[model samples]
Target: MLFFFFYLFFFKLSAQTNLKGKIYFDNEPKSNVTVYLNNTTTGTITNKNGEFNLEVKNGVYQLIISHIGFQTIKYNFDTSTYTKPLVFSLLEEEFVLDEVIINGKENNDEWEYSFSVFFREFIGTSEFSKFCTIQNPDVLFFEFDSENNILTAEAIEPLHIKNEALGYDIFYDLKHFSIEKKFTKYLGYSYFKELKGNKNKQKKWRKNRLKAYNGSQVHFYKSIIKNSSKKEGFVINQFVRKKNNDRPSQEELSKARKELSKSNVALNFSRKIDKPKNSIDSALVILKKAKLPKYIDYLYKSEIASSDIIHKENNQTYLQFDNNLRITYLREKEEKGYILRNPFSKPRKAFLQASNIIPLAEKFIIYPKGILANPLDVLYEEYWSYEKFAHSLPLDYEPNNDD
Candidate 1:
């Protein structure tokens, strides 16, 4: 039995594609450097000679390599098309942390408030956020611009977070983070490592992970890829959103109201309307009804099939469409945080998670695991906008109900 197990392990290793690379810093071998494929568990540490061997499935991947005090290297390539070994030279990065230290302490009140804001916007406020702890928040630096009402943050080193809810340890190479006017924008590369636990604990984690997976973006993408979105309890509608030209602009309405307000205490009565209905009310009616909505959206009543938006070219899957896609996952109800943040109430029969997908380009490639080739090529609005890392699974997560 032991011999069979050994054979299986070697067989599996032999089947995987290997990425070989070496790292150097200041013309010297950089040992113990962390090298990994972004967002995946495939990773390795550099040997004393600064060499690494990473194994993964045959696909294109975003590679990351780094060590503290050294500038990180990120490379994207296709494993199936590349045959040459990778060589990287990392540069030194300076750290000036005194200002951040003094800012955290000297202004204790502001620091506390800033930290709270960062915590809510960065790590997020989902149910899983309570179980996710940043192991090294000290490496973070915060700056708030009072005039712009924006908060920006940077980190000297990778941020390590342990997620108890998902049974994973996550390392985020944070590139940028900002929050302004209740909107948050952050960009980063991440690597995930599975946490070890006993059988019972593992069972519970599997349940939790499966729960988080259902109705997620990846799930929706996967269903579309399989052409089973409707069967999987997802309804899609195509809509065109346009400006409501019938509604007057705010400036026009304001100017009209101002002109009426200046009307010498009673001259508004001359503004003819039948029965002399309260001068102010008559003027307001003439000023364009304030109840007119600012935008009008025409939604198609028919549900679209996955094939309408998903296409394959040159053996690669692509998602393309006109206007926007209104997706509703009926299997899962909307998150409580999503409901509280949005203006919509849960309709009696429409208790579902709703999101809108807008393409920033003509179309974007969809990789095998439901990951977008360029995440920024499209915009995710509504419920998707509210979801952060606390509610996410790594791109490489292979789902299984029995996990």
Candidate 2:
């Protein structure tokens, strides 16, 4: 069951590498250790002798080594440079005795509320999400900060999630998860297993998988790397957005709000005090204005090619640009959810699958098959941010002729 049916996963691989490895704990062979490449179906569990083997195409991948009681190890490897018969020693997971979750008891009502928020933000709110289920949701612990209204969650182990829509069972090794009013952030590595189904179900899943992949970030990444954006029905536009000089920075606004609420919220910890009506009204005005956008976004009508913003230096392909990168996948129409959430006032704006990409760093090193060296180096918005586990497909997934 640990095997990924190598031939099936790497059927299209032009050049493949045979990878072999062993796991050890406290100087002894460790069995049943899970090893896999993140975001790909190239995975296998350790055998009785602690040995594992897998085949991968020539590419860079993050090799994940995980066990129930052992500390997880993420080893970055390249098929070209990494050789065979690799050995690893996993350390025991250290338990922190003092770290107790008190929020569940303090805010019992918020437990359901927090899980709802986590499910929406983490699993997503697309049509595919209805078919995704978290099998080990009970293992998740939560912490809610009443003052700041932030929700934090941690899982005792990898989350067992089944995506019936995609016919995949996913084990997600969650590292960080936190949600607040303005932002949500979670980081995890996932290993996928194919779910058996009837021919009809498999065919339907294939169609859905292709639909998810077509206008996705992965598809766009692949197109850019191959310099085939136009051929792939993608329109690239340079987005130049400027900060609103008329508005104060978020940090400044937050400080002002906190200072204004000092007599109101901070003083509540010790005793109850009445907030001055005029001061409270003034704070309300600033708080309402803070909810407005902070940037002035300029839409560019002149479209550009992927090659215009990407460069190759020393054989390493990277994306660098002055502002955000707006992408519109012309092959498919906008997901109904997006269209409903953001209705187009002008008929010209009724385009399919539009997303804005903002770079977190000055440059991002990209690879073939729509992967990035540091995936979090760029941020996504609009349609790109809408899809999650429910719409995910294995990197090796290929469409059948009908799909």
Question: Which candidate ranks first by TM-score, i.e. highest?
Answer: 1
Clashing pairs in 1: none
lDDT of 2 at 240: 85
lDDT (Cα atoms) of all candidates against the true structure: 0.75, 0.75
Q: TM-scores of the models, in the given order?
A: 0.82, 0.81
| Residue 386 local lDDT, model 2 | 75
Q: List the residue pairs that clash in candidate 2.
A: none
Write the residue-wise lDDT of candidate 2 on 209-293 in tens digits: 8888888887887888788889988999887888776576677678657767675443222333345355544454455557566
TM-score between candidate 2 and the true structure = 0.81
Give the C-alpha miss distance for residue 210 in model 1, angstroms.
Answer: 1.2
How does candidate 2 score on lDDT?
0.75
